[model samples]
Target: MPVTDVTTDPENLTMTIVADFAAPVERVWSAYSDPRQLERFWGPPGWPATFTAWDHTVGGRAYYSLTGPRGERSSGSWEFLSIDAPHSFEVLDSFVDDEGKPLEGFAPMRMKLSFTPTAEGTRMIGESHFDSVEALNQVVAMGVIEGTKMAMAQLDAVLQDLREFAQGKGTQVELLDDTHVRITRLVEGPRELVWRAYNEEELMRQWMLGPEGWEMTECVIATEPGQQHRTSWAPVGDTPGEPFGFEGEVLLVDAPRRAVTTERMQGTDGPETLNDLNLYEEDGATLITVLIEYPDKETRDMILATGMAEGMEASYTRLEHEVLAPAERS
Candidate 1:
């Protein structure tokens, strides 16, 4: 697995993967075209299915879940484009974020998955286009490509091992996956005000934690890709207590507009974990997207299971009631 090319700009990121398989084009087609079959072989092995619904027609949707080895699970939907039987197909894919909202920035992938019959078997080629090169890059930076490929490799293995049920040898898929708590809420506020809530320490502290008992003790900010911005919280009972902290570099920042990139260093064992936050204004309101990309399945599931949505909702709720409220008055 040579590292896929990683290129970035202020607006987008792109990733490409080329691989071949020994299965016939038809078999390969089934693995990608049919939602039922597609779900079986997708994602890292040991990933279980929670629910999968497929409508294999253009304008139809395919929804499925894949639980990773460490119980980390993800669910996403696909909108079919042209379903060329046994040869090619196109679909859109996106997951329900921690907020349980389909962040437009992260969904609707236009993928051209084609299979060419070869003397040995089939040469599979897939190309997914974004609304623009920037979107492609944004997702690539979000770590979707690596995750998608990991899941696809598992799919490849599953298809190869498929046996004839008539021969008493059939591949059985075990659907056991982890689940996450996702919460969604819409905020109506100016982009600048909302940006202040995130970039300004005074405002960030207001909504970043509970009452003073759990106030943010440490706040640091640096405006660069490798910079760090963090805040800490301490419980009520501890005396001279150290606050729980979050440490992450400033991957990319377009202050007053959006900040996209990674986080996680305080409690992790390796490099910083991944996170991104975006801000877009529409019709006098600012729409923001915040993403937390875990380094591995273990962390992914743990972070999800830790009530990320609830925690975030609490903060956003505060932002609305505290910060945005004041902005509205003025």
Candidate 2:
């Protein structure tokens, strides 16, 4: 479990969850496509799930039941509304009785799941919509959030097994020179979506936060030569209140393909860096190539020591799951 973030919007009657995994988009999607894989993590910790009549196509139906620690059983069914292989799927989820009949008085909800590939791994974003705030609150009050977290954690174990079954993985970071570094990764989404995730302020806000509990409070990106590209981040929630800012100048802008810029960290006396992003697409997948050039070797080494690379990897993972994934599905 790299990270999982859950947010509920009572006003919109929706609950959205974002999760990242150290696996490819295809692997993640396979978990749902295959009944055995889905059963392994469909329920939270301490609740083992069993599936019956499983299907992974549009208009198909799946039936499953989870046995609780105390021998309690809860059954459910999903009516697949739509399916897009390796990208997204929509379904109507509902509670059911032991005989596979819908439980009376319980509301059925719509859920959409999207998968995107990032430099580090794949991201899964699940959006569940209810008919009313009361319905939404009812489910949350039943421990859906905590249960979801546990279930997602279990998914990581499943991914580990899958990884062992077929070894390998992730972003390639190379020190091209003392003052230059190049990072490359195969991103599993459309080229246009990848470009927008890199350039759009709203999209950047989703994944560009430097670290956990850090939020991008301000961003103004002008993706044209000689334009301003400034962004700022601040601590959020229980996070420490240290803030950081970056001021950059765009040197080149190429829609859905490449972009070049130069950045300087605010309050730092170190040398500025030149950043270049190149996107290549084939069969709906994009390859992201990033090259960064620092003014001096010492400056680059010092920045790396701050664990900036790890933060960057996390951000890129979030970008894939929250922004790029949803965009590609849409």
Candidate with top lDDT is 2
The superposed Cα distance between candidate 1 and the true structure at residue 14, in angstroms, equals 22
- State, as a TM-score between 0 and 1, how close model 2 is to the true structure: 0.49
List per-prediction Cα lDDT, in the order shown. Answer: 0.59, 0.78
- Per-residue lDDT of 1-330 in model 1, one digit per residue for the tens? 212332333343323455566678887777776555554446433343434577889998766765543235566777887887888888776766443357555645666767888796777766765667766666766666656555565454335532221122111212123321112234667788888888877888788774334666688855666666766777767645455777766755657754644566577755445444545454455544453454566766666665555566667768878889878988
Per-residue lDDT for 180-280 in model 2, tens only?
Answer: 67676666678888888887777777888866888887799887788978888898878976788888788766577667777888666546888877665
Superposition error at 201 for model 2 (Å): 65
Q: Top TM-score: which candidate number?
A: 2
Which residue window of length 10 is worst by lDDT in model 1? 164-173
RMSD of each: 16.9, 20.9
Question: lDDT of candidate 1?
Answer: 0.59
Which segments of model 1 are wrong by more than 4 Å? 1-185, 210-213, 237-242, 265-268
Which whole-number lDDT from 0 to 100 does residue 139 have in model 1? 73
- Tell me the lDDT of model 2 at 106: 80
